[model samples]
Target chain A: MRTDLCDLLGIDHPIVGFSPSEHVVAAISRAGGLGVLGAVRFNDAAELDTVLTWLDRETGGRPYGVDVVMPSTVPTEGLPEDLNAMVPSGHHEFVERTLLRLGVPPLSAAQDRPGVLGWLHSVARAHVEVALNHPIRLIANALGPPPPDVISQAHDRGVLVAALAGRADHARSHVRSGVDIVVAQGYEAGGHTGEIAGMVLVPEVVDAVHVPVLAAGGIGSGRQIAAALALGARGVWMGSLWLGTTEYQSGHALREALLRATSSDTVRSRIYSGKPARLLRNRWTDAWSAQGAPAVLPMPLQNLLVSAAHDRLMASGDPTVVPMPVGQIVGRMNEVRPVAAVLSDLVTEADETLGRLHKLL
Target chain B: MRTDLCDLLGIDHPIVGFSPSEHVVAAISRAGGLGVLGAVRFNDAAELDTVLTWLDRETGGRPYGVDVVMPSTVPTEGLPEDLNAMVPSGHHEFVERTLLRLGVPPLSAAQDRPGVLGWLHSVARAHVEVALNHPIRLIANALGPPPPDVISQAHDRGVLVAALAGRADHARSHVRSGVDIVVAQGYEAGGHTGEIAGMVLVPEVVDAVHVPVLAAGGIGSGRQIAAALALGARGVWMGSLWLGTTEYQSGHALREALLRATSSDTVRSRIYSGKPARLLRNRWTDAWSAQGAPAVLPMPLQNLLVSAAHDRLMASGDPTVVPMPVGQIVGRMNEVRPVAAVLSDLVTEADETLGRLHKLL
Candidate 1:
């Protein structure tokens, strides 16, 4: 199961775990796999800096990474109120009406919303600045290639820059933009993804770029990791598999819903963050796809438009109306295991799977 | 490179080439792989009988198979004219207007249409009757499991029954219905496919059903075959790779379009057969997807309604309007080679890939 990626990333295994939970991130790093903390949930740079500082201490000198959302196109930058004002009333009404109809209760007090300003270039650049101030070994961008300045800044700090790509051309362009690694995220992946599946996209991206490629999407078990490597991927980047871990801080209702989900329980809809993100097919997603639903807003506006609604739904503790981004691998995430146990099982199973495949030759 | 599937099917390699061209089928079998001929094109029993007779002689006693379409639900059965009259005028106008807008010329004197009766139980039963009289080694159904009677009939003649499934539950049901082999067709596969991608679907199906599973969809190389084996599939069933072989009878224009395409050039749309089938994205598919286009009718009607337009597009010699059912693997079909060479390359590359993976262990 070892590859060049393990050496490059300074990890014991080639597996990379991605999650928004800082506990999960530190736990993964301590477990010998690279844990990447998703920074989209942090709008304040100081808050992110505090978390990274804690991560640096919690990981016990092990290497970890930070993932920031930087869309290729520069979006309108503002505070939460300004972005909320930009959202169309029809779209807002649709969300409100649908949430109300789905029995999602409202918040008594207005929750402090961050507006997903982290998706904007200005904030993501701040995230990079905060991330570099720590001992992070890798800096990852979600939607596109980090700016040349960001790439050079990370390089100067001796950190590798990785960008997620769904297509071969995107990977080549990422390499041209000076990225060190390309995460080939497939259509079955959570968050924003491209149309090609990992089985095809991984090989295509590997052929297109010289950098190490980590196959993403629909990869949960050891067999899937071996299959990804056989398809020419140097490693695997998994996010959905971590959502059910004990380290993931979420309500019991959401964990229960995820445990009950099958692979078919997810749908790729633009309703999430105005991009085609694979999300659980719950009442929230289904309502947006229903007849006469207003067209979703773009980029940060969509995220801002739905942030308050998300908070309300979370506050309500209603699983059916809660919004969660997950891949088809959710079907296989049947149990809640500790982070150490899950990582141990992944490595052991992969080693056994590789040995079995060797005998086939 | 061999698995239990090879010994069961009596082939040298665990590869199954699926094509509607008898020449391609015979070439695959003679080259030491099993080739399955698609029977949907032969609505007439006599026509299918003639082709099977030629295939039996052409392969020189090698093993081959036949694929028939049998939807789980019973569809309305009638002659071409009788079914054609049931099509709404608006739907007819949409097809006519679409073809006219796309510059597809009218066909010459209706072209002796057969009305896709092959999708019905009655016609498919006749197809099985004609196929069983020959030396066919296997019988495969595309849409669903073969009925109990059909499975028993094949078993009585010492023939194996295989069915395609996109989900673990579907594969289990197929095995329960007496299917010997289950083909885990992924979303990247050509023609009608389910939502699960191959990387996740293959392992899920293998764990669910005790029968041997053949990995299908997005497989066009030996490296993919090795990956499939790593994911626990006993064999690989390929369809799109054969479309570009020299034995395929498609027009030069359509062939050129296929060669020029990349992995992103295909879309899963119901316009092809009212089922979500992957097809080459072209002007025809684009028009049907555009706004103001009528909703695609259910199967058999959708096929009949667009059959003449498909013929007209073929006659127009316009690559942009021709309808072709292909998978994401079309991107790798760069040149037209003999079927024997393709099979040889697949086997050689697979062996080399297996050897390399063995060293990784």
Candidate 2:
């Protein structure tokens, strides 16, 4: 099952898991696959330093990576006094009214808010600097191409740089900007995405760029992994599949909703983060897309607008209104297994699928 | 390279080409594939009968299929005196205004108008009856599942029945209704399509149904065909790839436009067919989706509203205003080739791709 990607990343397998959990990162790397920790949630550099130190000790010196949300552009001026001020009044009213209609209680003032930093370029650079200090094998930009200096910095440190692209032209631009790898994310992916699907986007990106491509979105099983390889991608970058792992930090209510949901239960809406991200459709998404709903704002403003509301919704523990970023592959994630078990199953299934095809030849 | 689909369809390869041209249909079948004639353009049973007879003679006893746009449900009681009467005034004005702005001239009164059928159940049934009279190996419905009686009728005549679906649940419904094959058409596909991409939709449909599954949408090369098989699809069903074939009846201007257009040049809009179809972005599509554009009408009405205008635009010999249904794969189609040459290239490329993967094993 080893491909050029395994040789490049110095991993036994080509499957790369992206998650925000340190436990998942260590487990996936120890299981012979690459685990990329999403560092977008850390607002404090000291806190990120602490997390990376813990991850370093937990991985037992195995290779792992860090992913930051460094979008190519951000609003530079007109900084608001408070993040909440950036949100429109209509959007706030819509969220509050919908929660009220859904019979959800307000959160206590003492509840901790969700972290928000990666959307800003300055904060993301801090994260990149912290990540580079550690023995990180790779650094990935979640939103777009990393700045030229950041790519050069990673290169200078002998670390590979990867960027997520939803379109072929984006992949070409990333390659032109000196990215070592391109993750072709389809519309069915959990996070920010473009309109193209993985099946079409993978080959297009692979053809458009000279760099190795990693196929993402709606990839859960060995058959899907094989499909990605067949489409000319060197590896598969998975995020949603790891959400159902026992090591993830998902609450019981969220896990239950994910297990019970079908592929059709997800929708690509701008309600969660300014961009169109595939999320589990719940009362919140429905309310935002419903008639008379206000248009969603873009980028940092949208992230800031929903940060407090997301914290409150999570605190409320009302499953119907909680937001969960997941892909259509959630349909196949019917159980919570250990990370090791998930990796073993993927390898075995892929082997059997390849064996079946060999019989055809 | 042979799979269960080849045995079921009794073809040399699992590739199936769908087009409205008899010349292309016969050429594909002769080149060791199943050629499905798009019968939606045939309003008169006599015309379809003549075409089928010619195809039969051309293929020299090889198996072929017929495709009709017979949506399972339709408004039967509200039959209009003429097709134009069913179209709303606003939609007609929008089309006329857009064409005038593009400097397109009206067609002569004596010019023959394009046939508008299949959107109506009555006309589609006539198409099915005429098709069954010939030695059609398969009968496929382009929209929705064929009615239970229609399936039984095809079964009684020993002709297999297939239907196109964009969602997993829709595939299950088609299987429940006795479809022998399910064509999973993704959002990147030409003609009427659902929101899901072929990569995600194929595996989902393959898991949901017991019948053979054909992957469609954005498939133009052998690598894509291999990807479909890896995703658990039995074969590949193609539509847009045949549009630029020398055997097709497309005008030189239209073929030139298709050759020059990129994947990003297509848009999914509900202007031409009432259903969201991925078409080459042109002056007509841009006008319809432009700001202050009127809302598109329902299925048959939308088709009727654009029918005469479509004829005039094609007659005008101005490709910019003409609406052409194509997939994102159009970006790869930079040249026109004979249908036989295209099919031969696909087989050779697929063989090479499979051999390369075997070496990896």
Candidate 3:
């Protein structure tokens, strides 16, 4: 498990667990792997500050990182309120009509609206400021190459900057932008991703750039971890595998759905976010894909248009319509276990798989 | 370099080279890898018989395989002439207009019309009959599960049957339908393919089916072979990597284009075979993807519609508009080398890669 990545990150293992839950992040670090907190859901710097403080106390000064979604290209420019007006009325009507036809109820005024960054560059820069303020070991941009200033700021704070790339060209761009680590995420990964698979992209990115690369997408077990390293990645960056961990606070209905879904149950669509993201195939995705449906908008507008519909679905407690970003590895996540137990199984299985390979030689 | 797949198929190495030329196939088998002859180009049993007999004498008793394209679901049923009638005039007009605009010349009357199987089941059955008569070690179906009867027939002749699958469910279906091996191909693979990537699909298929799995798609190197093995595949099935080999009879212009093209120069479009296949992005693909382009026809009809245009493009001697099916690995294939040298490099590189992994452990 110990490799150049481990030495660089000062971790016992090269596995990096990504989650929005502070508990899962802390647990993964305590279990000898690097844990990264996804801060895209944070509404403001103050909310992020509180979460970082809690993570620092929970891990007891152990190394952890922060992940933010800052796409290299912004579809629109302006404040959230200004961008809200840019969405077409036809898209909004389509969402409403589809939800109404599906018998999904609307949300109450008292229910809280989920915070969406909406691909706004200003919102992402605020995330960078908050992440840099913490004693983080690494900062990763999920959508694309982090802006040059963000990379410089993280470096100034002695924090390594990483970016997720789906293509070899994107990985090279990240390296040129001063990223310290390149995370090659495949099409099977949750959230926004490129068409290339991890098996092909890892080796391509490794050859394209001089920096260490982390293999991501559809990775869950120790065997996959070994496969990533064999593909020339310094380590594996996993997200979907952490969604069902006991430490994470996934809703009961959503958790059960996650445990039951197969890899084929997911579809990559731009309905949830403006970019193509893999989420569990539900009525929502089918509605958007149905014939005569309005064309999906790009980036900020699409993200804005769907936010209200998502709130109504969540408030109504309709498990089938709720969007959950997950990778194809979700098929194997059939149980809820402690973070330590998951990490132990991964490490053990990877060792056994490697030993088996040695026997083959 | 050695695994159960090698022993099962009685080959010296686990690498399987896929090529249309008899010379490349014979050379690959002689160099310790399995050379699978692509027999889809043959119009009838007599044509296939002639090729198989030539391969038998060329390999000097070495084991090789035959590849046929028999999609599990036929888009339309009938003879080649009947299917040709089913193609709409609009699609025919689109093909002609696109070709004429691209400045492609008409095929010469003296040049033989290229044989196209056109996804008809009867043609595939004839291919199987021709293949089973030879001393073939394996029979691979490129599009879908070889029909159960085909698998049984191959088994009766003591030949193993393999099917290419782009999804885990597809692999499981292949095994249930009596395929002895499943070739897990990713989106980056050449020819007809699904959206799932090799990195994620290989392990999923390996876990879903009881039979040995061969990882395909963007695999073109020894390191990728090791990665497939680490992901639990018994072997690696490669196609695009063999296109640039010295033994392949690719035209001078096509060969030069292949050597110079990058990974990003390919696009998966339905223009070639009426199915989503990765081919070198050229004027033909661009024309079909352009605004106001007619909707591409399905399967056999689409395949039939494109055959004549492809013939014209090939006869024109213009490389820019020619359709060449290849994987993203084309970027790495910068040179033309003998089949033996390519096989040797793969085996040696895999051995060194395994050694490096051992050191990491």
Candidate 4:
């Protein structure tokens, strides 16, 4: 379990768990592998601060980190020349209407609830700054290379900067931009993914960059982790498996749905986030997939329209419309267990699989 | 379009277009790179005779190859293992019950419809024998590495041997066994696939083996081809795009499915062959995925039951149950044109994408 990543992070294993809940983050960190608290979902800075404080108190000085989204292309950055107005209004309307139709009665009441607006850039930056003030060991940027200033700032705080890359070229960008780590997320991953899936993506990124490559995408078990390490990834960064654990923060319905799911139960659909994110497929994703429905709206905008409604739908036990972001590996997550138990299982299974593999070699 | 793969394949481009139909194979072969004809569906002696004759006549003596499904781990030795009894009767009953329950009308009134029983190995051997009998240049094995005797036989004929590997270790085994080429089939690929996706699989295989590697997965457009080549692949093998071409013997329903598909529409399901193969998800796949249905039987058994129903379902003009095998890139297969045009576009796109990518480098 002790590898290059363990040496760098002062942890027992190279298993870096990514999750939205701070409690799970702290729990996993205490267990050994660093737990990275994802910041894309939170609306208020105070909530993040509260979560961080709780994590700090619970971990008893164990190392933990924070992650945020830094997309390579954005509507605000003006990269593709004409991407902002490029998306049709019908698409936006369709997304909004679908969320409206899927939401519970209380969702309409919370329709005007504060959303993750201006979060991609501004809020993400603010959270990073807040994270820097704390005893954070690492700061990771998802979707692309981190902004230049964020890299320098994290470096100034003795915090290592990590970035998620979908391609080898992106991994090269991370290395060139002074990233301490490159998290290679393949398409089998639960969140926003690109065309390149993990089996090819991981090693390509490993070869493309000089920095340590942490394998991400559909990695849930010890054997998978072993395969990643064997493929030359220094560590494994996972998200989907964390959702099914007892430590995960989830509504009754979403938890039930996740528990019921298998690997075949998910799909990489754009209906939820406008990006091709892997999520548990249900009647909602099915409806949009049919004819006559408008396309999904792009980022923050789609999230903006669906967030509160999503919250209400989950609370109302309406899984027909509520999307649960989980990777294809979710199929193996058939039971609820503690973070420590899951971590132990992964290490043990990986040891067994690696031992067997070594025999073959 | 020039790459390490082009250098290895001895072509102007690294693209290797795959088609079950030989006409498309010849068209791709004459265009520049190799064209591989799939032989899994090609029954024994006579059926292969017709197809190979068509390919040899059309290609005008140009170099082409045949792809076979040779599983190294099959439960056979001197004589091929008959997997009929190995497939649990429970699984077959499940299939029969499913068809009966779904009310899918039979494709033919004929009893004991032609199945994978008593044939695959002989068909595969016959295909190899016929291919060797032809003026072909290469032979590829899909399910696993080709048997040592087959490899030796193929090499003795001066026809190069290639094996599809889903992992670096698999590629390493092929290399150790003296395979000339290793096709890295990523999870993004259609048909029987390895657990690992292509992006990660490519470099791992490339780095692990001494032999040349061909990237196979969700590759379609030239950009994806360029990415594969850039990731240390010496060639790229494409499959899904061929189904939409003029030379393909596609039924009207299957062709419409491919034309209507987008990059977002496909998924990898084992519903067809009792193995995870990418295809357009439909009602049949959905039904099996629902609640507690018997798990899909492995390989030929699943193919036997599903193939019979598939024949009927496709003829019935309802794609909901007749979804055929394809890749994740089927979503990008939005038109039907000459296979040569598609192959050309892929090469052209690869060239443009490579140029842009080099700028970043």
Candidate 5:
């Protein structure tokens, strides 16, 4: 195995495992791939620091990274300074109307506090800056190209810079901006992405940009990994494939559902984020897609409202109207194995595919 | 305006207009584009010669091209020794059973000749030999990569070669095999294509192959032509957009329906060539998709069965089951104008689109 990615990242396969769990981040890095703890829903900068510190200690000096959602474009900075002031009358009223229509209880006065957007960029930057103060190997912008200062600062710290492009144009633009690697994401990817399917998008981005291309989106197995390489992607950036591993913090319901699903499942919808994103199509996503309903607000505002519903539904177990951002790759997340085992199998499968492809020539 | 594909075939634009009518082909080439007469169901050499001669005179020294379906993979050597030796008795009985069930007419004894697999390699090679004796500027293999001898001979004659690929892997393979140009076709394209869509597939193919990429699929207007160029394609390949112009040979029913379509009205189904091909979906195509209908046979075999049925249905004005391979671009085939009007509008549209794209920067 070429474990240079491990040596470079201070972990394994250059695979950046994305998760919401401190345990996963530590375990993945210990196994040789750096685990990126998602900080989207973290309520405060101080709380996030403890988790980062915990990850550092838990991994025994192995490197790790942090992820954040900084919109390439923000609608307005009308966000409130005080947490209390962030609550909107019409927005919450819309949420209340939806809950009433669904015959569910509204959030109580005690649970009326807003989300973490007021300081999301600053907090994420603080985390990145703090991680760089250590031996971290990379800093990636999840939503788009990272602001220029972040790119320069990462380079100054000898960390690599990466951005995701849903189409070839975006990938070329990233290369033009001097970004080191472009993640050519397909619609099969989790989170926010445009409508282009993965099998076609990878090679397009690889061809469009001079920078090394890492194929992301629905990559979960060795066979898929092989397919990506054959399509000319140098390496793979897996997200959903990591969500079902033992190290992940996925709830039993979603995890089990993921493990049982086949490739036929999953659909791209905009219910979770304001933008179109691929997820397993369930009643919640379906309900919003049907009939006369207000279209979801574009990002930032939509992200603000949906997080509150997710918080409530997790406790209520009312999955009918609550959803998660997962990818079509969830269908292939059939078992809970160690992160290292998954990585090992993926590389092995790729080897076999290359061997078979060679014989045909 | 350059009418023939220059340098390769001593013509104007490398644009080859594919139409069922020799008259239309002649007019298109005379008007400054290479008019390619489709030889799909050409009965024999004598009949083809008549059409070619007529085309030569009508175009007034303007060069033209010929398109033949010489697929890379074919199951058998095509037609058997004779009518008796060709189709199996069992297969013949099955056809009779189907025709009786559908309440169709029995075959006349004199007309029991084998179907037109007259374009089999040996025959097409003969046709090419005849064509080499003529003034064709380019030679295209519609189904896949043209044979090595076909490529070499065309090159020897100083004729250009073009092959179509719906995927990046295929496109790269074409370039590696010494192809001069690649037609990057998307699923929205008429004729055979994979499930990968155009907006995604075009750029991928462009990136994967070094040869100049011609974007094909649902492009019909100036805006779409500009979009293809923006996506990194060198030029554009059109098929369906020309089918409804007054110079083309479409009947009233087909032309009216095409004029009324939108971008969303087409479907990719293997009903036509036993290969995944996009066309305007209708009752005939839908009927076959519904159940356990025997899969369509590849190439000449499927062509053998469907063509006869289509002629009969079309004669009776009930072609609800006939599929005319059309692109999503059929939406723009909203008028019946002269071929010159269509060609000039496209160039103008592309120029305007480039202007708008620059404004975004």
Candidate 6:
């Protein structure tokens, strides 16, 4: 199941595991696939620097990457309190009403106030700076192409730059911006996504861009990975499949909720982070979509308005009320397994699938 | 490349070309793939019978099939005028306003009144009966499992019964209802579809069903066909790819519009039919979704109310006003070609893709 992406990314296999947990990222790197830690939740530059420093020693020097969320057009930046003030009171009221309706309790005084200033350009730039300081082999931008300076900085350090694109044109633009790889993330992906599905987008992006492309979205099994490679992707970028891994830092109840979910259990809604993201259909999403609910504010404001409520819901340990971003592949994640076991099973099944397909021709 | 489905369906290749045009159907069959002619557009039994007879001679003894749209629960059957009377006046007014806003002229007196009586259970039953009288090898129900009696009737005549499913449970239900094949149609499909995308739906359906599974939705190229087979589908069922074929009975301007469209130009909306359907985003779909527009009616009534306006829009020869049911694959339909050429190209490319993946193992 080896492809050029394996050599390009300095990984044993052409699989890239994306997770927000530093533990999962280190585990994936140790398991032969490249582990990419999502740095969007790291609001403070020092916090990200501390984590990357930990990750540098955790994987025993295996290749790993950091993913930052930076939109093409820079967004407004401010302190958490200032961003909260900008959110419309009606939207805030709706969130409050929804939390109450969902039976989520208020956070305790000991808990820190939740913030989403990471969505701001300043924070993302800081994340990139922190990531570059570590021994990272790759740097990825989740929303769009990283700024030109970031790309140049990564290249100067001999690190590969990758970006997630939902359309062929987006992939082309990323290539034009000097991205080394394009991850064609489709509509069925966990977080923010576009309308095109991976079955259509992967090949289109492959055809559009000159660089290698990794297929993402609705990819849980080895057969789907084989299918993605068959569609001309150099490898597969999988995120949602890692959520149920033992190393992922999610609540046990939320993990149980994800395990019980079917493919149809997810819906693409803007209630999560004020951008269209595929989330588990729960009270949080349903309440915001009700008839009287106010329109979700955009980006940083929406996340700032709902972050505290999200924290409370998670702290409540009520799976149905907790907001979870997941892909349609949630149906296939029926159990929690160690990262090494999951990667081993995926490689074994992918090789078997590829062998089976070879017989067809 | 052959699978067990080729032997079961008695086709040279594991591709099923789905189209309403009998001409395209015969060409696909003659080109060594199974062609399933859509009977939902045939309002008269005699008209369908005539087309089946023509297809019988046109294919020169090649295997072909018929596709009918029958809701799981039968709807009220009535004459065109009777059904039109059942439509709510508000919906009727919306359609009228939409046509006017799009500058679509009324159909001439010489043109026949458009009726969607074919959507009725009685008409669909008639289509099945007429198709049984021909040499069709398969019968596919597009909406849900054909009623138990319909399945039995097809089985009694040695005709295979197939059903389209968007979820694994639906596929299991179809298998329980005695379907010989299941077409796992995804959200990116051209016509009425469910929320699951093909990349996730195909393998899930394949695992759930005991019978052969054919992958559908966002399937335009040979590479997509290879991807489908790699995902464990026995074959591929493609509909949108035929829209630009030379044999398809569509206006040149409409074809041009499709050629000019990218994958992003289509939207899944219920404005086309009572059920959710993916259609080309144009003035027609936009007007129906604009603020103050009445809610789209369900099923037969919705089609009845919009039938006249649809006819008028088609007659206007304006690409933006014509409602075309197409998938995201519209981006790849840049030119008109013969069905044989399309099939040949798909086969050639699929074999090439499969061969490439084989080396990876």
Write down the lDDT of every candidate, Cα atoms only. Answer: 0.89, 0.85, 0.85, 0.73, 0.65, 0.90
iRMSD for each candidate structure, in the order shown: 1.2, 1.6, 1.4, 11.9, 14.3, 0.7
> What is the DockQ for all candidates, taken in turn?
0.75, 0.60, 0.66, 0.07, 0.03, 0.90
Q: Taking the tens digit of each residue's C-alpha lDDT, what string does model 4 give over B35-100? A: 998887765667787778888888876678888876676633222235556667776676677767
Q: Fnat of each prediction? A: 0.68, 0.48, 0.65, 0.11, 0.01, 0.89
Q: TM-score of the candidate numbered 6?
A: 0.99
Rank list by DockQ:
6, 1, 3, 2, 4, 5
* Candidate 5 deviant stretches above 4 angstroms: A1-11, A81-94, A100-120, A319-321, B1-361
lDDT of 6 by residue, B58-89 (tens): 99999999999999988766787787888888
* Residue range B263-294, candidate 3, lDDT tens digits: 77889888888889999988788998999898
Which has the greatest DockQ? 6
Candidate 3 global TM-score: 0.96
lDDT of 3 by residue, A1-361 (tens): 5789998998989999899899999999999999999987876878988999898888877799999888787558777777777877787789899889877787766776754772567777888898788899999988877878788888888999989998899889888889999999988898887777677778999999999999999899888888888889999999999988999987776787788888777898887777888988888789888899988888777877887787776666666777788888878888999999999999988887777777778
> Candidate 3, B233: how far from true, in Å?
0.7
| Candidate 6 global CA lDDT score | 0.90
Q: What's each prediction's TM-score?
A: 0.98, 0.97, 0.96, 0.57, 0.53, 0.99
Q: For candidate 1, report its TM-score.
A: 0.98
Residue A85 in model 3: shift from native, Å? 2.0
Model 3 chain A: worst 10 consecutive residues (lDDT sum): A111-120
Identify the runs in model 6 with alpha carbons over 4 angstroms from their true place: none
Of candidates 5 and 1, the better by lDDT: 1
Residues A1-361, model 6: lDDT tens digits: 8999998888998999999899999999999999999998887889999999899999998999999999898777777778778988887788788788888888889875656568888989989888898999999998879999999999999999999999999999999999999999999899989999999899899999889999999999899999999999999999999999988878877987898899999999987777789999887788877799888888878788888787888888888876888999999999999999999999998999988887887
Ranking by TM-score: 6, 1, 2, 3, 4, 5
When 1 and 4 are scored with lDDT, the better candidate is 1
Chain A TM-score for each of the predictions: 0.98, 0.96, 0.97, 0.91, 0.87, 0.98
> Candidate 5 residues B1-361, lDDT tens each?
2211244445554355677678678877887667877776676766677788888788889888777767776445544344235444554454445544544454456534545554366566666666666667766667667778778888898776778887787888777766777888776677777645555566667768877777787666655555455455666677787887778766665776677765445667765665778777766566556564566665555656655555543333333433578876665566788787887777665555444333221
Once model 6 is optimally superposed onto the true structure by TM-score, how far is the C-alpha of residue A301 displaced, in angstroms? 0.6
lDDT of 1 at A289: 82
Candidate 6: Cα lDDT at B24: 94
I-RMSD for candidate 1? 1.2
